[model samples]
Target: MTVALWCILIAFLLPYLCTYVAKISGGFRLKDNHDPRDFLDSLNGLGRRAYAAQLNGFEVTPAFAAAVIVAHLAGNAELVTIDVMAVLFITSRLLYIICYLVDWAILRSLVWLVGMGLIVGLFVVSA
Candidate 1:
């Protein structure tokens, strides 16, 4: 429960951090009312990718939490491994977003592999 809660918090915060980074790099005044389309475009696709990554995190966390809870309810305390997995997923997501923003191709792909591994690992170990 604590792990899921922290994951939810990080999931929410990542997008906000991405948005702020976009604003700073795009030279948009953090206060003025301006079109997001233009500002985001100026960030060169990283802003969009960051937003997508955040969405992905939000979508995945709930199912992961549910599975962990189910495992716990079934008397499998090892479900805590799922909690650790969720953390790894979040970390990889952050790395993926950062790598994409910086155009680090090989490293970005590796980060993506880490995220996928976490998801698969959760199911495999839980079973």
Candidate 2:
């Protein structure tokens, strides 16, 4: 598969990584599994931020995946261009999670914008 396609897989999995962080930091246990959302909602500080990031990750992943697929299917942009943007989007998401955990709101928003721009750029390049 293409690197961009691989990135779609990474994007899909990123939220799970954030979920893991939230769980580990929030002291999740087997009992919490019965009501995981409630357990996640009770988290504070880093755990809460991680959970929020996880939700955001899930929100944006589909768009990123779609952008990559559309770019590939359109077959207008260079494969390298699409791949690089995909990688950059993933990098921005990682930074966004770190920013959220560290309470860097402004930086996190900027990183989020960058990710969004990368997604748009994928479509634009395909044109």
Cα misplacement distance, residue 121 of candidate 2 (Å): 0.3
TM-scores of the models, in the order given:
0.67, 0.96
Model 2 sits at a Cα RMSD from the real structure of 0.9
lDDT of 1 by residue, 17-122 (tens): 7666666656677465656556654555655565555555566656555654554455544646767777887888788778867778799889888877776666
Instruction: Give all candidates' CA lDDT scores.
Output: 0.66, 0.92
Supply every candidate's count of residue pairs whose N, Cα or C atoms clash at under 3 angstroms: 0, 0
Query: Could you tell me the lDDT of residue 76 within candidate 1?
Result: 44
Best by lDDT: 2
Task: Pick out the ten consecutive residues of candidate 1 with the lowest summed lDDT.
Answer: 68-77
Per-residue C-alpha lDDT of model 2 across residues 22-79, encoded as one tens digit per residue: 9999999877677777776578999999999999999999999999999999999999
Q: Pick the candidate with the highest TM-score.
A: 2
Could you tell me the C-alpha RMSD of candidate 1 in Å? 3.4
Q: Which stretches of candidate 1 lie over 4 Å from their true place?
A: 30-34, 45-77
Q: In lDDT terms, how accurate is model 2?
A: 0.92
